[model samples]
Target: MQWTQCITSSQKRLTSASLGAITTLRLETSLIHGKTILLADLGLSSFQLTEDSSSTAFIGVDDFYVAPEFQTFRDGHVQARRASDIWSFGCIIAEVLTYMVKGSGGVKKFCDKRQFEWVPGTWWNRFHRGPTTPSPEVTTWLSELQANGEPYRVRMVGVIQKMLSLDPKERPRSAQVKKSLRGISILSLAKLVGHDLETAYKDDQCIDLLLGNKRFRSWLSAFKRTFLSTKGG
Candidate 1:
């Protein structure tokens, strides 16, 4: 069983580059970046999927991938493999597109404690940044948007190939994910916030700041007094 939708708390704050990419895409067309939701939450079980089933039906959840579930050693954990991240992103796109084609069906939706989607960049930009397109033969989502006026289906095909490629080196860079799908109406998760669900999550305060209100602040003081007193710092 593949589990996608694992996002890091750090991702809630996007880098300047990530924000820049997203802003540019939005300027070009009223692009919408939706929240990052995992298909696993939908409870869709995986089957011994064949090559054919892979394309039309939902991809095996075991293979479902998203970029953010990747971990950094800073949080006291093993660093996430870049290849693993790319693979996960591929699953996210497939799951979303599949759901659009076939109703919820066997697929499920999930929310990780720390996952966040950038309102700015495609999965490719979320992973790597490049001045030019990375793939010559494999078109990126940005490219598709530039070439044709529509590319919903084309984008999914590329995500599937890169995510499932046996050779990690053969997979496309994350920079190309949004670029290749250029014109397609691959909706962003941002627009869905108030419409689909309501939360103080998208509020003005930083998640950490929100978590550290007056009550939490007192707790932090106690924690520091107990922990810091024990250490020199």
Candidate 2:
């Protein structure tokens, strides 16, 4: 399904960053089919389209998913790049993964874990603590996700870690992230359907059957295990 429009008339009064956060929550609840979904420009709304139409330039802020560089820009202009979009997509996917493994409460706890006092009374909860460093809490939470050892969770966490890299240049492009996620989904479906990974990946029919089954799709979304229990982080 298409992402819900978060920038409604009532929401127009909200800050752009707040709109982004609302969009993120909507994404968490949306039905995301692994193979068919590819978010190339998920959180980028303030970019200006160039005359070429194929090219665009970042001019303003889209706060909640703003890259670290944008946060530190002093000159009022931030040259947001494609890598910035990758970072935003990474954050979105990370939350989606959290919701998949743990429930919405777990996602809330995850956010709480990232919060810290920026100054006397100001607190920040972005994935990055500074322009060049990731939040320690985010790193720790990722480590916990890695410890789960479930193949899909492990692989996704790895992709997310790269996506949330402090340096935008280090983040993978949208195509790469899409490929990795698709592979992970295939492998997980293989495991779920009692098929070998190779067979699932190579057999188009097998993939189609699995994707076409409503029950399978439902199971995929609702599937949960003892990952990061609700007791605590």
Candidate 3:
């Protein structure tokens, strides 16, 4: 679909760096070809845009998804940095991939083990120990892909590894991530499902199928009502 809003503040590389919060990232769903598909929730309230700074610029970050850089800043070890968002994105990808391969609640169970706690030394140790012993979710997902001979799964894992790098500077920028993912060719993935999708299939057409679906519109409306009522109360 239109990645315009799904992609967030990290789209622009900042001159300086700062820690910020992004607790409102959401997933919206729509029916596509008789199946429900998740889309990034890009409501006005979804993203909290802020400029970079040497200090913690915002609060209320979701601990479950907070980047290591933000954790370091919170611990008074470093200045806030936007590259933390890349880490957050990596976490999201990890969770999504886990859910896809392991089925429902996989990510919740994975996070439950960590309890969203990031002890500096312990966390750093685990971060560096990745690849050799990648997260169980990543390892399993890669295995599944390998079994199916999904050519791009390896490349996907590589990009994901970079995003989850322990050092923020080592993480790829948003554009780089986008370019890497685009190179994988969604049509190729679709081929796995026996769909003879053409490379000529426009991205907007796919977005239209998702966003313009009646089920999606209805769900969005109901979701908005529930979300607003909960907030208002």
Question: Which ranges of candidate 3 are over 4 A from the true structure?
Answer: 1-60, 74-78, 115-149, 187-233
The lDDT of each candidate is: 0.34, 0.58, 0.47
Which TM-score value belongs to model 1?
Answer: 0.31
Candidate 2 structure quality by residue, lDDT tens digits, 60-140: 543445567667767775465556656766777777778777889978998888888878998877778778777888888
Model 3, 1-233: lDDT tens digits are 12321343333332123224333232222112323333332232323344522233434444455555544444544443456656666666655556656656765566554432234544431222332233454445445544655555555566667887777778886666765555444434434422222222333458545444545446545644553354111
Cand. 3 Cα-lDDT: 0.47
The TM-score leader among the candidates is 2
Q: How many pairs of residues collide in each model?
A: 38, 0, 3
**lDDT (10s digit) by residue, model 1, range 1-233:** 01122221111122112221111111112222465322223212322223323111222222213233232225544222334435555545554554555447623322121123334552332322221212322234323322443333444454565654544566565444443333122132222432333244345556654554544446545644653353111
Worst 10 residues of 3 by lDDT: 23-32
